[model samples]
Target: MSSDLVRFDATRLAGMIRAREVSPVEVVRAHLDRIEAVDSRINAIVTVAADALGAARAAEAAVLAGEDVGPLHGVPFTAKDSIDTAGVMTQRGSPIFRGRVPEADATSVARLKAAGAILLAKTNLPEFSYSTETDNLLTGRANNPWDLGRTPGGSSGGESAAIAAGMSPLGLGTDLAISVRGPAANTGIVGLKATHGRVPMTGIWPRVPRRFWHVGPMARSVRDVALAYSLLAGPDGEDGFSTAGLGVDAGVGREPSRPLRVGWLVEPGFGPIDPEVAATVQAAAEALRGVGCLVEPVRIPALERDDALEIFWRLHVMEVKPAFAEVTRGREGEMFAISRAMLAEPDTSVADFVRAEQAAERLRDGFADYFGGHDALLCPVLPIPAHAHGLSEFVINGRAVPATHSLSATVPLNVTGLPGLSIRFGTSRDGLPIGVQIVSGWWAESTVLHLASLLEATSPVRDLRPAI
Candidate 1:
């Protein structure tokens, strides 16, 4: 039981803990031991919480005392280093923030703690959480659990890797472009980027471009993602952008009563997809069709527009980079190469910035029209499977595309402030995981979760675990 305990999702672990099948202390110890054994090769965890054992002991005592327990009572979890953890280093994967500690946990972390979830460790990310691959000067690179030679997608790479390797059952990861979903897709786990404001981003690092940035859950199963989402979603009164969903369920058992209209796309207007990846995504659609959904292949013209990536970049340059310019003025050399390069680029003109904003508006409106006729949309999470550790670009199907093209599928939802989720559904010929992204209208996480849950039910990779 101890050896297999790490493979269970948080939902299952919580139930076992509630049934007294296992003690909280034992659960935490099993994971800590697993991390100690495997994390050296994966570099997933940055800092193990010094007081994790103490927390577990207290949780064990509560269960023995027969006190009321929270839904996640005693389940151990990890947080991306960018999310604040009181008295623990929240270094944002940069040498500049080394030794930094927060006086209080981020809103989501505090809520998780209050619900009795024990924090076991903080995971690694790319420096400033800006890149797609999780590597930093402070904590180093987080390797993919599926293949050590491959990468766990960034900036939530460490969180995904740790969960895939069973070091932690659940974690918090932020997403702007593909931070959460991309990593989940790459690592064959579950990741949710709820409606932009569904989860508050209070206490998260580099809190710029508030409209696009999001913090959400990553877990081994969609049920666990739903469980964490229930606790983490809602306005915290601190983050203005988090005011949309004040109290939302994680949408676990709320399956749609009627047949769902699910639109799936393998092309999605994003140029160049690996044939294997497209087939896996199409297979997900078939699974949905098997589950009584009206799954159809469709395309979004706005998303297909080649300018979508350019628009996302324009907004990033105009809004996000300038927000951090003051702090990074003298320390550009200390940042990641990607971050420095982005900062070094010429500023966007007012006309271009306005055009980009309009493009985003078009995307939001386009999704609105598309969702009016469909309950959810399914697409490939990435054009290709997780690539080598440090390749800047990947050649997909036959076309050589820029590495940042990885964001093409995800940024449309980000631009629209809608909900998007990634769930593992298939495996590549090389045994790598492939995931499909589910998107829904603004503030429609329930719809997204419902479809994702359906897909999860029949996914061939549902029970698959990485050979880490």
Candidate 2:
């Protein structure tokens, strides 16, 4: 029963809980037990909520009293450690803030709580949430549940690992470049990097480069991600960037009025993509076409002309370094390898910063042009599947590339402030998960989520669980 409960996605769990077939206590305890059984091996969870059961009991009482409940009533969800949780430890995966607890919930966390979801726990991340893999001096490292030697990707690595390993059905992960989608691709799950500022960044850390940072949902299914987005979307009036009104429909069960035009790509733009990963992107395009949408192979010249990953690094370092320097002023020795490496990088000059900003605008304009002719874009989430942990270099399709190249496919969306979704659509030869990215124009997350649901329904790899 516990195994079955753990395997259920958040949408199904919420339905079952509302139907009174599963008690809130039963649901919460099952997850807690699952965590106890599996998390030591994965190291995904940094802190389990002590009052989770108490919250569950209260939910059960409300249900018994025939009171109204929220969409995620009694369902359990987790958040990356960098996302503040009221009364819960949010150490930001760094020793500089060890034992720190927030007095209030982040807008995302508060919204989930408002939806009746229990805060299951806080997951791990790299130091200051600034690395490609989930490891920090505070929480050690997070291992992929699929292959213990591999990573789930970071800074949302622990969140992806937890959901993939059945430790949590749904989670919140923040993405600056590839933190949310890359990890989801690595672990074979669903992650959404909604339009920048669509979800507020009121309580997340490292707000220096607030323009690039985004808080989003990572889950086992697209519906859960869409549902989470619906609740987490509107502005809280605290984050200046989140002032945009929530106008997208979320489109879980709706279809487009006309045939949706989608363009898929795998080369020239996103650096060296593995052949297998490229094929997976092609397969997804074909699947969308099979579903009666207008799908074709397409490319944007901006992606090929200006490297999105390079632009991201150039722009972010200018803002990030000063913040890191301020936070770690006297505690430099407490830093991890990733944080130290970031601090050690050559500073971005004024000329370079201005150039990158101009390049970013060009990238956004490029996407705007593409969207003028298409409703959505389909592409690979990562060039390859999950790699062995702690490696800073990689060779993809016989081309040597830096580890930061993994962010190539994802950073463009961040640079453009576009919405994108990552869902597992294929398995690698080594039995790893391969995810395809679905992106749409600004404020068109409904289009992204709509197409994702269609693909999810026809996905060949749907519901394939990791054998952890």
Candidate 3:
């Protein structure tokens, strides 16, 4: 029974709770036990509610009264600290925000709570959730469960670590660039960034122009990702850019039946992919074909000379600089290295920011045109697997690559305001995990999940638990 409960997915757990086969208390206890056993080694979590037992018991009593349980009943989940959690220390990994608490929940958190999912706790993230690596001045660093020496990934690194280590069944991750997919890629979990504004960003920090920022979900399976997404999606009234679309459930039981036409690319936006990544993508293509789906290697014309990085940087600077300037006003030493550099930029002028925003609008228009035909485009989530933590720079194919390009494929999707997700495609020869992104154009999460499900059915990454 213990093994069965441990192995149950969120969808299965919800069913068990609804059927009275499992109580919310039992589910929460099991997860707390798991977290207690693994969290110290990873430092993935900074807070845990000891009275979670009381909450779960109350949930069980509500269920016994025949209350209409939300779709995610009895599911235990965690979120990155970058997001605000009412009553919990929602520090964004900076001492500047140490012990800071919000008076209300983030819209995403409110939605999940409304869905009957337990908010177990919040996980760590990079300082201000800025850097791709998930270490900060507050909670130290998150170690990869697979290899303790390597980073799990970041700014959702703590969430990814917890999910990979089986400390939590589902986690909420935000992806401005690789916050969701990076840790997902490094930790061998599913990370999803729904279309820009698909989910409300009202409570996330530095909520500026709706350009590159996105809130996403990370879990062990694509089905879990979709389930979490459905609960968190739709408009919250304040984030005017958020979609008012109907949210669809895509759990294991609620999965689509048809195979999708998956158009994929082994090479990323600019050029050739890592040999291992290319091979894995090809293997996924073969697996898709075996499942009676038509998979083809296609070039995305939008991937060429897009100036995506420039647009993203310019827009981010314009928004973030002012927000930070208000607090750190004149305290240039208080900003992170990247934020400091961005603050120093005189190039992102009022004229330049306007033009960049217009360019971004054009990019979004082009993506909408491309997704008219393809269900989803499959590509490497990152150019390479998890590198050693704090490597300062990346050396891709003998070229000194910029640190920002470490997770290039997923970021451009953010810039385009499209929906993208990372799934564990394959493992490296050394056993490190490789991730692949299935990107669907703006607000088209259903297609992305459909293709991801098909791929998962074919090339399944088996339960390779990180040795915590």
Instruction: Indicate which candidate wins on TM-score.
Output: 2
Q: Write the per-residue lDDT of candidate 3 for residues 1-468, one digit (tens) a residue.
A: 654565567888888899999899899988888888778888898777545677788889989999988998768888888788787778888767778988888999888888888889889888777778878666888888888788887789999998888778888888887789888989898888887778888888877755567888888888888888888888888897885565432221224465566787865464446778777777877877787666788876666646677788888866777776665665656555655655677757799888888877777776667667666677888777788888877776677777677656776787877778888879988789998888876666887787778777776575666656
**What does candidate 2's lDDT look like per residue over 1-468, in tens digits?**
777999999999999989999998999999999999999999999999999999999999999999999999999999999999999999999999999999999999999999999999999999988888999898899999999999999989999999999999999999999999999999999999989989999998876669999999999998899899999998898898997766644332366688988999998798689999999999999999999999988989999889888898899888888888999999999999878888999999999999999999999899989999999999989988999998888998788888888888998988888999999999999999999999988888889888998889999999788898
Ranking by TM-score: 2, 1, 3
lDDT of 1 by residue, 1-468 (tens): 788899888999899998999998999999999999999999999999999999999998998899999999999999999999999999999877889999999999999999999999999999888899998788898899999999999999999999999999999999988999999999999999998888899999666668889999999888899889888988889898887663453332366678888888877476588888898888999998998889889988877663667887888777877766766788777787777877778889999899888888887777788888988888888889899988877888677888888888887777777888999888989999998899877777887888888888888878888877
Every candidate's CA RMSD:
1.7, 1.3, 2.8
Report how far off residue 374 is in candidate 1 (Å): 0.6
lDDT of each: 0.87, 0.92, 0.78
TM-score of 2: 0.98
Candidate 3 error regions (>4 Å): 1-7, 247-259, 330-338, 350-355
The model with the greatest lDDT is: 2
lDDT, residue 206, model 2 = 71
Where model 2 places Cα greater than 4 Å from the true spot, the runs are 248-253
Residue 152 of candidate 3: its Cα lDDT?
84
